[model samples]
Target: MSNADTILVTGGLGYIGSHVVLELMEEGHSVVVFDNGSNASRDVIDSVSRLAAGKGRVDLFEGDITEPAQMDKVFQEYSAISTVIHCAGLKSVAESEREPDLYRAVNVTGTSHLLSAMERAGVKHFIFSSSATVYGNSAILPMLETAPLSPQSQYGKNKVEIEKNLHAWQKKNGGIVVVLRYFNPIGAHKSGLLGDRPKKEAANLLPAILETVSGKRPELTIYGGYNTPDGTGIRDYIHVVDLARGHLQALKYEPDNDGVYIFNLGLGKGYSTQQVVDAFIQETGLTIKQRRGQRREGDVDACYADNTRALQQLNWKPEYQLNDMLSHAWLSHKSSLM
Candidate 1:
């Protein structure tokens, strides 16, 4: 928790990790980033280094998580590491369906490898970047942490498996482990230095909206036009900065009688696909063409979060609303293109 605490952030060059790294540096913590850069670029690291302004140093480890030797090298170099924020995993539902083998190899096997390395290195604190997909197609409107998990995609199943593995690991090791089951994380850092950098084509809505606004893509497709008030699928979209701050707070939490904790990070409000498109148009004053398409293969009707537990436990809550999310995302999008 000190300024000198060497924290290992896997996938630190990615969208979510870069924001979290900035937050960690702001809190005066030293970070070592371990990313394969398969889905990221060296430019992101350069951007982060510039954002840090020499206040924090980021040591990059470019290697796949499935490789044990690569992970071992990180532990060997940074033996003083006390906490790890594991964010290094493939996270596309459509892609996972196309390549289940890759998902199992990276999400499942890669997580196991990281756990083993952390255990061997004596790192106690662990924070897992889990997903809302674990509670797939929930009958509950705003899904709670205790909601029954029925993951619809391989990516969701991977997250469920990882959370279970973390539980088992905690039971044997007696260390503090926090699993943050996040909703749709949108937006970029307010500084415009970090944002979502998808390697392949983006499946998420915000990035697609940005593409439409930037004239890279034409006509945003509104999948499924028979769901809710707007006749489109609704989702809980949390700002990336707020989500990153939640991770920092999770790291600060002490074990509550039990050593493990799980909390959902979201805005506790739902936004339909049409609503998002409308918001983007309103924010950017750009005419975004739209096409009504069929529902995505693994799409769900609606899912937000009962963020009360996160507020109670981690003393964390999102400050940005939908408008703020849209504005910040637009800022990052414009900045990146420039």
Candidate 2:
């Protein structure tokens, strides 16, 4: 009953989490998925099963990290789950604003509950699903991991709070914890078996574009009148598959010299809203009807990443280009219709 090979992934059926689960299974690790079915379902299980090719072990436990009792029961049941890639928690910045308390309760408090369970269970390795929003509004073009911390939204603030708490906990806890601060994650699995077609209304850009093209929405609304080249916000969009591989690399990292390490997971390239639209049209040959809208609160003008650390430390780099991202994304979206 070695704990080293058993991994527990929260929110394992979400967009990014599902891909990571596939990678984990591909790498022959036993995975236990704990999700509340808030934003996911067993639908992804079918995809993972196919992607796994019966090479890895997997199980499911319907639980919430915020509920101590549920979390405790899960830990007791899957005592072999020593390493965790925690992907559960509310993700949308806009949703967080509409419900700040919900953000705090789930993102911050829920993480605390998970930490307690980890300590009690004596789990050693932890990989947190963090966002680039933790960088907030920095004037720096390619933000580094050491940039000043000034989170704008409740979602970003909640991540900062959780990071600070993890710092404190890492002092007493003797294990490796990798906090992956992700940039925009778009696209789908190359196989088109798993993709992000959320049950909720569109909150992300690529999904909005897909929905607009698919006629789910009348049109796509581009946010903000920014002072960028195209008067729209600039973001670093890493293909979801590339981002998924980062987690696998993080899990494989030795981290022998440090207790906690932070890495920015991105493609290290910035693309504006207009640029993305043009690229999408070029890649998919589909027109996205767009209307300009006022800038959403808590969003920065330009935010990319300095991915040097990830490449040097984890031997990870973006292998997919923007074209590859768009093509795969469109294919996945089309496959969903079949």
Candidate 3:
């Protein structure tokens, strides 16, 4: 298979998906972005196009992956989309608990719907946007891809279910499937053009912290009481751009490589929530008022990654440091407001 397949990115305007679109364009891959326009906008199309600068072709379609007819239309129009990066899903843990049915419908059933569309379209290569949340409240430190399949939250359960379903689908149909169990994806494209935002508001950590810096909120709240030394949860946060590049790597994965390839996308080191806040303050010389609170349910004390598999298998390594993540994320936050 050629590396230049016209790749279709579901939720293409989303934070991680947009960054991957830019990377694909930079690498001269023909790209098509399919979005529901729920969590993102047409503005991202312009940003990605500008980044591409005629290096490649980019086409956009306002659609949702959950709808088979909509995805079928996308497939019909873009028959050249031989590969897909599935990123469309409901992602909030709290929201998932409130509406497990929705999460299941979107993340699991919706994904199954997408896989069916792919099979019909004869698109054999797939990359799924999974989360480390699948590990969920584990006793393990620095999780490996081989970690247990016990997820605690509804959101995480959704990811785990879809991963299992994908494994089953791969076994039956046979294709190149890559499951990327991503840790916390912070930062943004180094160009400051993309950042995370849901259809409604921000719930992720770095975005919440940045919002506080913008004075959109009064203060940052650190959920404390975890078993970690800082009394807050620790996570391995990878730069969004680095995580995005991993998708491109998966796309370039050898066609002969059959079966499911799983990799944990992270920095292989953990940082507490407090540490992230302090890093932000240090990076920008900004004072952030933060208070500790009780640990939320389904919380883990520390969860990093054992990313040796990704490095050795994908021939890719995370390049940005904590400082780079802090600064670049802040810049992207500012850019989003502008």
TM-score of each: 0.96, 0.97, 0.96
Local distance difference test scores for all models: 0.88, 0.89, 0.87
Cα lDDT of model 3 by residue, 84-178, tens digit: 89987878887888888988988898999899999899887889999999998677777989989778789989999899999998987888899
lDDT of 1 by residue, 165-258 (tens): 9999999888899999999999998877689878878878998887776777877888975568878988999999999999999988985565
* lDDT value, residue 161 of candidate 2: 96
Q: Report the C-alpha lDDT of model 2 over 261-299, residue by residue, as the tens digit.
A: 999999999999889889999997777889999998888
**Model 3 spans with C-alpha error above 4 angstroms:** 1-4, 255-257
Report residue 288 deviation for candidate 2 (angstroms).
1.7
Arranged by lDDT, best first: 2, 1, 3
Q: What is the lDDT of residue 73 in candidate 1?
A: 88
Off by over 4 Å in 2: 1-4
| Worst 10 contiguous positions by lDDT, candidate 3 | 1-10
Local error of candidate 1 at residue 152 (angstroms): 1.0
State the local distance difference test value for candidate 3.
0.87
